[model samples]
Target: MDGQHYMERYIQEVVRRLPKGQRVEIALELQEMIQEMLSADGEEVTVESVLLKLGPPKELAKKYRDDRRYLVSPEYFDNYLWVLRIVLLCVGLSVIFSAVVNFFLDPKQAKEAAMELLYLPSGLLAAFGAVTLLFVILERLHVKFEPSQSSPWNPSQLPPLLQKKAVISRSDTVVGLVFIVLFCMLLTFAPQVFSLYLFSDSKELTMIPVFDMEHWNVILPLILASMMIGLVDEVVKLVTGRYCGAVLAVNAVTNLCQVMLSFVVLKMIPFWNPEFFSWLRKKCDIPDLLPYITEEAFSNLFLGLIVFGTALELGTTAYKSLRYGKN
Candidate 1:
């Protein structure tokens, strides 16, 4: 190959593995170095001989990438792994739950259940990719990972040595915030996606909306408020690293509002799709399923479960606040 062609090819190979922003600059630097090396010989040096002295493209790329090729840098690697594991766990659980639900809803759709399982690996990969991408962005932005940079360290703000149980974990708060954000997005943009669907044909599926959309005018605002409050509370917990009296109070108020809203929404509207049971009966020819699958029964059961869960969460929060308030 001609000297210029050889140099261009060699440079292209080395730069291809580097970050886009640094590729041009690195290439120029490498070209300059090669020219200097050639001129120092006091004779015309062929690109082949210059490259022979410089070594292989892979080794050159490696030298350029030293300490810089990591998707998540050392400062954030632990956090990145932690987030990835949690996200993958959540994704796995979600996939399993969805598969189980689908199986129960339509036992004939065995392929659908299997497909959900098949999706688990892809879901985990996607979660891993997303977490890695986020950490990469943060790494590039030079986010400070040091405790001093994160928040003011106050020895007085620390909980008592005996009250180690009072401390809130930042990781837990972040994971909760992530779940809340995902739920909020689902509720706001794709509420129907949560609904049960029946496969009418190989290529056709019929959806049954889970919630009464007519009551959405009243429900959406309440849901949005509750989710926003939850998100804010989690963010505060993440930032503060410990729950103070003020944080506990805010959390209590938000939980109360959420519980109250849940009750009101359940009372004022039937959440289970009105047509769901009827459609199931007509299409599946399963009369025996009627007694157990009544819409009212399902709605009441769902509401009761929500109330119980909310009340349990509230009680736990209150207990924690009281038990550790002095700390």
Candidate 2:
């Protein structure tokens, strides 16, 4: 049989066991190699001769089978993953609880006045989604190899456009670095305003605002905190992109520190405890609500929600990182 006929049979033999996308790509590449090797004017290239020249079809199939276009790790997470959920849940629950309590404590007159300018949870999701998209796009366009060490799964070299950008895009790089620094600054000091929007009241809208601050104090700061947390998440993505697997463990400790500190501040305040109630009551007129908040029932529910939430986020992030982390 001719080279064309040989290639057709060879591809048919090899494509069945592979994934559809993988099969198609291998078939197309193999067809091209065969055509390049034996043009129409060439001596007859039988299936046997072509097979001999190209090497065993099983070996060829094995090569392609071993390759990975995008890393596919099993959804495996250990202790580190659970800790993240703990932190996020704790912070979310505490903030939500604080907002609800502070709002209702105000008189009904102050309620309507502040309703127009409260924090909305939707704003937090939007900010997080937007920033995370930025990283997702960058990850897709990136080259996966250095000049000296490479694989077929990795591009042999960076594209001309990316090479040019690397050589001459100092300003863009500097600006990106600057923005990252600014985002971290926001995360560290005042994470509350990241989601604050001067949202105009609309006839079509019916959602109630959550915070009741005098100005944007409640709405703005809560937004900032959500955005800042999202920023830290993106930072984790960026750092982990270069080194997957064990490298991400750095986040575990940092997150634990922040979560532990927040838990202490929220839960261990002496004045909120009735055992120290007399000293606190005389000092600043310790409110009944503060003591109530420390009660076992309330604390357990809040802590449970926090732990559950943190678990969900950690599972999510771990799965996501495992899928997209390695370049």
Tell me the whole-model lDDT of each prediction, alpha carbons only.
0.65, 0.42
Stretches of model 1 off by over 4 angstroms after superposition? 1-162, 280-292
Runs of candidate 2 exceeding 4 Å displacement: 1-31, 34-223, 231-300, 311-327
Task: State the local distance difference test value for candidate 2.
Answer: 0.42
The sequence of per-residue lDDT tens digits that candidate 2 reaches over residues 248-306 is 45345434544554354335532123333333335554466555543454445665676
Instruction: Give candidate 2's TM-score.
Output: 0.28
- Per-residue alpha-carbon lDDT of candidate 1 for residues 1-327, written as tens digits (9 for 90 to 100): 357766776786566556556788999999999899889876866667778777766557778665475666543455556556666776677677667766765679878776768777886787677667766766686643212224432222223433456667766776786697567545654466677676765846667877777677778777777776675566445433445565676677877777677766666665556776666667665667667677666767777897788778767767766787454
What's the distance in Å from true for residue 20, model 2?
15
| RMSD to truth, every model | 18.1, 16.0
**Model 1 compared with the native: what TM-score?**
0.47
Best by TM-score: 1
